[model samples]
Target chain A: MTAGVTARTYMIVGAEPEWWYRDLVSCLQATFGTVLARAGVDPLSVLGAGWRFLHLPGDVRSEEFYYPCPADESGQIDLGSALAPHHQLHSRWWQPADENDVWREVRETLADNRLVIAAVDNFHLPFRPAYGDVHAAHLVVVYGLDETRGVVYVSDAMPPAFRGAVPIEEFLRSWGSANPSDVQDAFFSDSQIGRRCLDVRLDAPPAPLTPELLGSYLRTDVEAFTTATSTRTGLAGFDAFAAELVERCRAGDADALRELYPFGWGMQAQASLHGELLRRCGRQWNDPALAGAGRAVEAVAHAWTGLRFTGAHGLEDPRAAAADIAHHATVLRGKYARAVDAVGTTAARL
Target chain B: MTGIAMSSVKAGLCDPVDISGHRNNTAISAATETKAGAFNVWGNSFAAEYLPAGGSLVHVDGVPFEFPPVCDGPDNIRAAGQFIGVTPGRYDWIHVLAASERRCEDTIELSFADGSVDAEPLRISDFWAAPAWFGEVKAFESLVMHYPHHVQRGVPAMMWAQRVPVTRRAELTGILMPRNVALHVFAVTLQRHGQLA
Candidate 1:
């Protein structure tokens, strides 16, 4: 330990962070769910409330937890806002203020009784299935840092769900790894785990999701989708993105397919959650149209599987894969348009 | 019930179509030779020990299926729009032993002898530690997942017994698989329209 570093432990007062997960979501949503659960919030209700499509070309990162994050006017990226636009949820990425004392920030965050979302390479975490086999960047919730015991309390909800203590040395290696390229995992590798962590806070308790409240949120999201912005967003933005992706593949650019897998996951997971939430609300309120709209959104999520896997298997031959890529993209675009229409009609009634 | 009454209500009236000719993907592997199977882009496979033996007849939910060859060679059709011919007979259902790299929903074209074609939905859940989202019967499950380099525990590989309806009361001639590369079909069976007879 350093000179002023105390050989002590810090942890939250309540129970361990709950593991919240859906089959279609990635670690990005899973870790965020754990934090929200600790804050006395239903993970799905908030995470599944607002949904929109935003694809940033040349801005995709090779990480399992990568999501399209846009910076505000002051150049500060708030991932919480991007993920949950309907609520007062806010998040900002931070690193250790002192390179020499890397645990300083983690200790302070734990002491404040809040969870820390740490970025790490699965290759180094023993609990991860990719440990010593593949290199992929992922996220996990950190609930405790027992420097005295030389173990960090970690919780992950992704497949092969794991929670418990990890040795400090191994956690450090994973958290600070330079996740290099691996042939086995073409999509979620080649990204650096630069000890990045997300500090998320829900400033206000989410309002009970009544029909009126949900209708307003849906109207706002529907507007975002119908309106064209400077950035790649909404229905028009999706058209622009899909066209360029097919063009790049046809031109024999392999990088285009490489970026599609990670980028599509965020959009897919969002649609699935949003769809599930709508279906639940619909069933409770005896509104078949709302439930059907949820199913339409889910079809959008399902359609992404074809496009993503086609691009993945076609990585070896981009030109040859262009036809199938275009076919799936067209199919996905149709699903998106249909889903938007359904949600719009349902929203007006609500 | 009389003998005649018992004989009239017969079950197991399904023909297991031989799809050996269309097997193009090796998705099952023994723990010792995990490198041979490449089910997904990550080169993962189902553990052979936990699955039915090679070339066995397995019954799932009253439907019989001829299990594909296990460690010998490719055990599933990695759906690439292959067309499988069936005996021109009236059928009520098309049962399949299927799994996908992820939760997938696609369409399959059913061709009839009368030259009519219909597209039916083929939904399969993810094989990697995921539930059957489309309410498919869990036909077979490998307790462990076989990676190219090692056998991973706690992550089960699942194969679903899903069926598509042959709603058209016509003699089915052929079935056209989807162009999706993520969907895999191990075995298929055509159940005769016994109730109609």
Candidate 2:
């Protein structure tokens, strides 16, 4: 560590965070993936360890990085745990301690050799495709803060991927943007940026995944899907969610359609990753049933396209879209049932 | 060009199917007025300059295709349970130029000239800066994506060359596309089995 109390710059010693990304993932998983990589864990195995359906009614946020993470019994929200249920990952949202100096927490985190995931408005970030055109909430990795040079090093793995220095002023504006709604993008707008940042901590390194370990996780997930719980969970939970979605669409509730895009993303990304992981393990073990099960899970991911885009296109005149909306929802439900059955059977053997 | 050259020499190869009657969606747009094209929900579309001219002949992997008209009118079919009748013939594979709202794999039912029917897999990758996850060829790419209001750089829009197998030996008659709105088909060609064995 640098000796001087107020060093001009602070950066992690060896290398920048690995850019872990997939086409289906949101900024939420992309940022967490980078953090998990820096902690010496394979981001895919940890992030894709579990898959289940979760939609908290009236809890959806209009942000690109929105993920459905329900608060715990004690009312604590851990996005890290939500993303990586099988790993010892935890995350909390925080803002600058002092309104006068917003960089205080960021510099401290950098000094501690931890990368910060800051929420920024794409309209103000010059590297973002939406810069100066659309106000969408997004996430980026902040590796270093050079107060002396007036630059903030940032990394984003989304398309037109960028990794370089951003002027501190530009960064600040993006981080503090109101993210007002624009006609161009109705899905990811009208959310306040509020300079929120995630403080992620990998309390313990993940253990190497084994067949038995993965099997247990799969079993737990299957049981969760099969068992009826007080909260929205399992196939029953999905039924309730789907029913309400169709009913709301017929009633012309725009918010229901709006929430589906971002909320559905988390579920879709989880299924894709988990399915990919299971397929990899099945190939290594030469288990055809397991491989088929993985493919089934991937089908669940692909089915999300039908439902999500239907909601997206059907945003206006949702009443007109009700039939097709119900159609995709039913199709997606069938996919979930098939996938869960296949995964359950395979897990029993593994 | 090598692909196009190979297309001219191949024997009993896939004859490009003329399905102009099926074109119902416009996925390509001019930069001057980007709002005309609505390929996906975000009002993004492929750039016309980066693609073949309207009504041009193009080939990918030695397979011939009639490239759709660009920005002129309906250039693609946003699959919504559309059924297209094909020239009745025995075929080995069904090739298509397609892009999805996102990565998608759906089914397309093939009705044989006889009584047999089979559901073939139709997979298309995302046009919005995504790799072909289902082992498809990168057919065409617009280096810049067109948004509703402005041109977006760095995010390239892609069109893929994807194919589905015609395992049945009977002559093919028609294709019943899935009700998937996410899958967009620009052009299709039927490769006859006569070229093989």
Candidate 3:
């Protein structure tokens, strides 16, 4: 490091990053939504275009943005591909190259006029309701870095949304926090922030969503759900996941319930967005069948509340909660089946 | 939050049901005793200051409700298959002031005195700074959320007014709340059959 070298300042030119959010989504989708919106694309059209159920064993993390992203044979995972199966969006996780200059990657990304999705700890961020009270791993978009002013510009679209400069010291603490486990937040704590950041790119602008295009998308998703694979995906995968979850709960394994909260959140959020998009499309096109199918899919999302919350409250007694857990799992599975059938039938006609 | 008023309904068509025996959860707390409320798993609750007085009569869209006792003790009933028996009557709508740990859509069993039972949808939106996703009327809100240790500002808690239809023409004798632990019912009112209640 050269002595007396002035630190560079960078900020994405244009309006502040827009806060794109839905009630059901976590920070993962919210941050991605903001980035996609900045690229002149409707966040929902991209994020909600495809939906599938995938659960990788031991892949769940105690982070709000945790979503299962399987790696290829080459050991590389593309979160963007996992999120938008039908789009040219891609993302990669990266960390600061030099520990001495923790803000290097952020500066470079901001200089390139790209927004960075950085992992953070809620306990350290003043704007967070959990600030200094609870430790929870979360994600937020970083739009600018001002070394000269000693503040880092940040934006979060979640509840009590905040956008503005944060003291560099505070931001760093949150970004690099160990995020020790707090009893208050069993689902999102105990995960390390590790100064991680997600670099997202929309390789191509999405085409207008025509009826035919949506039909094709629905058909593909329907096929994915109906076709059975060795992976934990689709109806068969959900069956396996649910059975195993119930078994573990019966065995009094609390970890099963813990994982269920975060893992179910990802699935729940996806179902909600997909259903909302389909319903909107249906209404706009005046297609009652499609709208009905969307409602079915939304029922799957709503059913998740029962299962996830049951598991959440049952963390204290997995064995006692097993029956209720199994009940909700069965209910949710039925919803998935019905929604899949409805979507398939509607897609066939579309 | 104001409700959409339905015209042409009789002035005294609503009857506030007594659910005092079913109050099993404390969801509201004064700023001084935030720890007393545990609305969600996180021990968060609604601030008493922003709510109607305990045991007060509150109205939304001309539907009267006997708001449960606040801060004093259990103020809401966490749904767990509790069978709430009502006066046998031919009601058009069963209105409830409810909230859920998250946006939930479950079913409640409506038992008629004619020995027939029907399952009706009971949908409630998340109370954690969320919108009324189920098209429920926003009945009450705590401007600030109360955590066990402190009063958290900027995050508000919500209570919704949602209803389930008594589709059957027979008298409704009892309502079996779903076994779902996510739902919480604070108050209930029965609107007589007629005029868009």
Candidate 4:
């Protein structure tokens, strides 16, 4: 460890990389927490799960220059300026034109302060032009570099699969030759990973991804749908069918409404269909206003379906319209039940 | 967007071609490259060579389909127009053909809307899988139908899914984990039956 290296270096090296994109973001958040803790900043307040960071812009296909400080007196981070010592000391490196520039900027950044971070490119195994041809790119932290061993230790977001130090020269050459289109972004740090050269930890065991932890990574969209459906259905257990119906409606299934008309006479009938499910589940319609709005929408759909099916001639028969609306509503409810059940089964593991 | 909505109006069959016996024959070998901005539809196998922008050579129910100058030539075939305009509506009775077979007896009903195509009654026959590579070949001996959608939003811009019987082996292989399956479906709607301007 160097004089400026913090105790948190070993901690970051041990963490697992998350699989999903959101989980990956969470991993970044965790890293920031460690960084803030070392800086004597309250991790909770300054760096938590959803903290936003300043995004450095870069084009992978083009060799662009980046500067640490703002070109103007504003002292902002100017991406175009050359890398400097003070900038490097901050603990992270911005994207530079080439490997030579990355090395030079990293050295300067580290000299100013041990806090700097640099973004480095990690090459994958069995590389091919096809793999390099895509627009996807990965970001990793440069923890250390050993000149003699010719290795650059990286804290990759793609953990287990791509964590640890790689041959410095070979890594750079592979990175440089990568289809420029695939060069996404890099991370640099004046922290231990950036300055202290260490051996790539290939043998270091990976952290487990328990089911409980995986549940935490559930998609927000799925969660929102679940919550809404549960509230609307009021069923003690989640009604997969009703949820599917709502999803189909949200998906703009006009025929679904038409099919629902016959089962429910009017908007009130439709509301009851949703309301009864919720009531059976021991849930209350939390918002009366929303409940009223839902009824009104259902009424419009019921009336439209009736008119279309009965034709203008049949429009004179109010009974026929009512019967048609009820039939349609029943069909919609049936379809909703089936879809919800399927979706529930499919997503049950989550 | 408005034109897309208006263009949702379906056109009648200009020249209906039979598409039987094209699947599993490998009679046509064409290279398809997807590009940004405009879709490109080109193949080595074609009766008459016709080029169209914003279109790609797609495989539907084990059969390959070329758009614009539909089929192989300069006859001003405009079936690709279905994929051009938007407004997400279903179209019935979509068809495709290969260059090698002229019998054209193969018929498939394709319902397309919202950038996805579903080919029903088709089954997977054989597949190729190894380490990082995965590929599958599906064979549909019986009746084949297609339902496609032109997704302006949500998921893939263009998608096609087919169901076929397992008469033969389906082969699939790739390096990276395959994230998605690309299905070739048109995004045009049928406003009127057999009416094309």
Candidate 5:
């Protein structure tokens, strides 16, 4: 061991990631939003411009950041492409190349002036509410590292928004946590952190959004919803998914409810952002019908709350919760139908 | 906080209602025993330190309200379709101290003496370190969130003052809460539309 050698310190060159937050989004969107904002792009325009209903059955993970990333044409999973189907958002998960010296990749990333989005366990992070208690899988941003001071500069846009340094030992533990099963948080626990980090890149700047441009996106999404596919997608796909969910609940399958929370979050957040963007555009463009359609879509987002929470609270006895689950699912289906109809009409005019 | 108060509270415009009987959820916890609270599925709660004395007459923007108990049992009403009978009178607004598991928008039925029922939108923002998305008044904020096992700093738990419009001119009978499991009501005050209201 080189005891007398100075410890290396690396940090992104004068970059303070902005906090891009919404009540409905998880850490995945928030971290990506921050990175996108820092790259001089509006997060909503990229992440919320287009929306589709895709429920990859048996693919939902027990993590707050779980979003269905369908296999690409080349057989590789690219989450960024899935999240922003209309934009050039590229992301891929990676780990430390050198197992013995894990900070090497981070230093190189920092040297290249890039922020790292790292998966972490909430139990070891001092800022998390679950610190020293539950072990839920979460994500945070790492912008700097100082080996000499033994601290890593991190930022988390989640509740109690934090932007400060954490001890290297504590940060490493959280980053590399096994994230074992915890009864406290059924949806976000049981996923290993594995010191995983996401390398995000915005390949190109988004085109200026206009009524005609947004109308095209809306038409595309509406077509996606209406058309049938081999994968779980669109209105027909949603009906099948909801029917199976209700059937599973009636059969007392707890796994169905367990999967609902994380899966529903992605859909809810997408609707929320898309609706917000539409509303903002409608007002700016003085289009009353578009604004009303935006509100309808937001209602769809709000409707997810009822279904998701009902499924969450009913985890103990799925059979007993079937009626309520079925009721909420029916209500949500109605909302999606109405919202799609409204957005479809509005898009046609635009 | 100041901006939140502007949208939520109407000074000298509200009459505090008797809502203690409707309290069914305990959302505030003492530092010593944080496990007593079960506000959400995860058992997170607001800290008692940053709140008012239990059952005190507190005012947000001059609107008086009967603050619920602190570290006491059942400080808020976890909405479950409970019908709250109100004094028969005409009111313009129904101010409520509330929060939600997430951002929620639902309807609360207002019953009138004419056998009429009107459902008004009841929108509340998330209490978990969130901004006022629904333009609610920030009534009280617990600087630190209380978990079942520990008191967590930096994650502030918020209480909001939101309102529902009572458009009917007829005599109000009772209010029917929504069947949503995510919404919680801490206190309610009816604002009389008249000069003495």
Candidate 6:
């Protein structure tokens, strides 16, 4: 019997069915990384460093040709000229053909380790009008096939909707219909497609710390901030903490200075606070003082109070605060570096 | 253009000779005229002004009150101050105020110019106290009156002609005189029932 891999088990875990394409992508990348590692497969080697799904055009082409211009290819095929022959291909995935055949082709494409991306034309589903167009669909891995259900369980680059598990029938319909004049219905003949499949064992989803994903994890914090509970003071306490740090820096406190360094609390706070300050200050951040102050507060708040306190401060998400800190830290660090460089240059000249 | 100086003084009031008699004060009684609509007490009493001698009606404040050349007769001049009589029904009197100079402070008193005791001398103080008087009465109410002007320019100036509700007719006891300075006052009395003899 195969050892139970956590990543593989998580692949079957039910998720919000109606996740967006981007959300699914992020989840796949995250899950696949851990899963592949646990499966004894080097994720880096299989997935490649900085591996990303390339977007495909949602149009019909004159001919089928592998993308990234395969080294052995006879130059680039002009889409307008190739449209006729490409349409004549007997691939089941190409519509005006059988749906089951299309599914088989898609499955084969996934198994090939080639990235299969479908540009959904008029991507909105009939049941869910809000999903709008599935501009891009990237299949990262095929987990398994539900023979009884006739459904393919696949990891996608797109975020899963709240009602996860996109129906194979529905996905095919969208994928087949997205035929633009310049490109094919979906990316089938790409060199990268079916090139390398990673034998990754997926892991349990990580607790999302970023603001966008914070909603899934920190419901209470979001509610507290939205309702404006006095308990959740938002960056006010963080501001105070930052001020103390600044004071310590002014006073030449080695410990405080060390805390402010770009490593642990200081770096985290700076990144988180910078994001928060950028949002709050918006265009007002043209002034250095206002922007700096916003960043300082963001950093201090996140460092002293794990984003859980964001709820206490009437803030729905700590991720926003974290983002602010990060942005502010970056800006301040750049300025500080410049200042230091100027001072060093002057000293060297003297 | 030639400078035509207009001046007028009551028989009992001080008068300088050789002054052009362009200044004329006319009054219209409200007793016979029917009130056409609801007591629009706040409407402008002085709808238009006209100087028969043709020069702009230069207000004492240096602001010019544009009076079109439409007033061809004395009746139109009398109708200029006809707004005071605008009660819900026919009124026994219509107190009309006229400014003779441009700065707003030169007092104009209408009296029996011929020294005929038949015409009563209307006191300026009496006109100032009546509810039907023009302009704001309460010192503090004036501040409220200014609020609308602060909201927009020219609004308060237009609101200056609104009517006040008062029971008594104001009476002036002196001769009518138009000083070189502008004067804003209400002229009040019982309207004449028939044609004056």
Interface RMSD of each: 0.7, 1.3, 0.9, 21.5, 1.2, 33.9
Pick by lDDT: 1 or 5, better one: 1
Over B1-197, each residue of candidate 4 has an lDDT whose tens digit, in order, gives 35443333322221222222111111111123111111111111211112223235443332343433223223221111121222232223323221100000111223233223333221111111101000122211111111111111111111222222212121111001000011122211112123433
What lDDT does candidate 5 reach at residue B4?
51
- The sequence of per-residue lDDT tens digits that candidate 4 reaches over residues A1-350 is 23224321221223332222111122232333334344444333221111000111121111111111223474433321111111111222244545455565444433333322332222332221122222222234454555556665554332222446666665565344432332121111111122221111112221232333222321221243344442232121224433443454555544333333222222222222232222222223253432333232223222222222322112234343344334333543443343334323323443
Against the hidden true structure, what lDDT does model 5 obtain? 0.88
Candidate 6, superposed: residue stretches over 4 Å from native: A1-100, A105-142, A157-164, A179-350, B1-197
lDDT tens readout by residue for model 2, A76-185: 78999888888889999999989998999988888888889999999999988788888999999999888888899898988778888999999999999999987777
Candidate 2 residue pairs that clash? none
Every model's DockQ: 0.78, 0.73, 0.78, 0.02, 0.65, 0.01
Which candidate do you rate higher for DockQ, 2 or 4? 2
lDDT string for model 1 (A199-225, tens) is 999999998999999999999999999
The deviation in Å at residue A337 for candidate 6 is 14
User: What's the TM-score of every candidate structure?
Assistant: 0.97, 0.95, 0.97, 0.27, 0.92, 0.22
Candidate 1's C-alpha runs over 4 A off are A1-7, B1-11
User: Which regions in candidate 3 have their CA more than 4 angstroms from the true location?
Assistant: A1-7, B1-11, B194-197
lDDT by residue for model 5 over A253-277, one digit each (tens)? 9999999999999999999999998
Candidate 4 overall lDDT versus native: 0.27
**Clash pairs for candidate 5:** none
The ten-residue window of minimal lDDT in model 2 chain B covers B3-12
State the number of backbone clashes in model 1.
0
lDDT measured at residue A318 in model 1 versus the true structure, 0 to 100: 99
- Per-candidate clashes come to 0, 0, 0, 115, 0, 84
